[model samples]
Target: MIRYRFGQDDVLRTRFAIAPLMELIGAFYVLRRPERYVVHRRWLKWAASRVGDLDLTLLDAAAPFGGPYWPVFVSPPPREPHATIEAELSRVRETPPERVLAEITHRYPDRLPAAARPFAGDPAGALGELVEQMRALWDAVLGPRWVTISALLESEIASRARSLAALGSRAAFADLHPSVSWEAGCLSVRPTSKSATDVNLAGRGLLLIPSAFTWPTVWPRIDPPWDPALVYPPTGIGDIWEPADTDHGALKSLIGCRRARILQELDRPAATLELAARMRVSAGGISDHLSVLRRAGLVTRRREGRRVVYARTLTGDALCRPST
Candidate 1:
């Protein structure tokens, strides 16, 4: 999905997402997952500058905030926004999927992770990898612990829509983004894409990535908004953006770590060293991969004071569909 659009009032929209962003950096954040966290921060930084210019253009030249484009959300109705949006899009009529995708691709690179766009030469293959990479990214994010946070935030934002969905109304956002919905009694948010500009980044791979802008991407059916506005950084900020591809090849496990198989092997929570023994990997190596998985939302870690324990998240459990 690698969708690059978001609602104007996304719940996670932070004016200063930079600080929390800094916390998740380094090996603990990077190698754990592949492109997601890797690309997200760059997008955020680039997009930050873009938003100021976009808002200035919109609020000043395009039209007033109250015109057709600006829809208010002061206690809006459940599922109403999504449904209304569908109708509005219908009013615009169906544009060619290729054109729609192209416009998004052209606009998104600056606002999204540079990895999102497929490498120039192999656009199709790059797009497929991008989508799949993005989906993998979602699997890591929107999982259990995240679901708890998502639920809390949804309650704060989409209290009514969530309530109505429970009572049965189309697809709930939870169904699309399992991690965000992994928690019981949590509210799910579907994408409205209002005020959110679309960037195709071209959905080439799997996992239904909702936005490349947000790392550990998402799997919302309606593609919930993450960033408030489409951000575009000025050129020469870094490397010239290229469409993402597995050109360098998939990342190697940090020596002796096969955390996925280890997690797959476990039936219960296990100590790092214990799983390390089972996986035949060195304790240090297991620790490193566990750290990676932990960041990827694949596995989780908790300190029993001196010792740390790792386990799979509900999203992981669902994904693994482990035998009971």
Candidate 2:
């Protein structure tokens, strides 16, 4: 069992973040283990043809053998809540050669994946090549759908943040994943493998990262020189590929199809343009619908920075709640 010993400071220092590249890496697992991730079967079938002949042996090798030691340079914890893929890739590019070599050698001392072996001779060049390939893979497979994916991730973070505030850390961690448990100030993660491990936060704290792709299990990154983190599947991943639940027939009967969907989609606050993209409607039309909903006391609008975000009110929530 992995134990994360947290001091008072560690508890205060804990934070949450969303990682785009981490999702890309997690997608590799989904591709390899479709049976384990049945919700993503459609995505798996679609992604299979798009991934082409890209090499993922290095990522595969990084998976837990006796221990989980993913190359830190590749999947470092995010510095902020909303880090861009470009910025994270830059960090990977700037990773010192020695660090890369150390991680590679430590993970595969004798035999290495064919894709990672070349890094031993020229860590800088080979690692750079790997990063480029990762970028291409992201563009081809995930970039197009990042909007919907990121929205789902952000919604999960917001919900967890609320839980942390209202119910405290223990309740928050308890709800993170089935394999995850917190007791006596230590957070334990039981992954799919039979191996049991212990990780101590040592007052360094932890980063809770919500990922759309890392479903069915919670993945831990406890290697040294990197802030410890728990990467777990976020809620609502099943809806990522499925169509929006616009079949709110009762809701449609009351508010019309477009407005009912707008209400359904507002489970999380979103701006007009984002709503437009998700609903496949024009900004002007969404604005009109939001105006009506706001007037009817079904939705409210607030400015988040320069954008006007809309969210359903309590009355709206009651209306949208599924009938028992």
TM-score of each: 0.23, 0.71
Best by lDDT: 2
Per-residue lDDT of model 1, residues 1-324, tens digit only: 123332333322212111111111211233333354444344334333433322121112111112222111111112221122223223222333353344334544345333333333344444344333333332333222232222222222343245333643223333333233312322333233334433432221111212222333232222222322211111121321222232111222422326556656443557888987787779897777777777776665555547666666543444443221
lDDT of 1 at 78: 25
lDDT tens readout by residue for model 2, 1-324:
556677777777778898977887887777776788887876777788888687755555543323545677777778878776878888888989998888888877778767677778888887787788778878777875565577577678889888877887897888778778888788877653535666666777888899988877677776556578878888766656764333368779989989999998887668999999999989999999999999997887756558887877645665664532
| Distance from true location, Cα of 213 in model 1, Å | 37
lDDT of 2 at 294: 90
- After TM-score superposition, the amount by which residue 62's alpha carbon in candidate 1 deviates from its true location, in angstroms, is 68
Q: Kindly provide the TM-score of model 2 when superposed on the true structure, using C-alpha atoms.
A: 0.71
Colliding residue pairs in candidate 2: 1-197, 2-197, 2-198, 3-198, 3-199
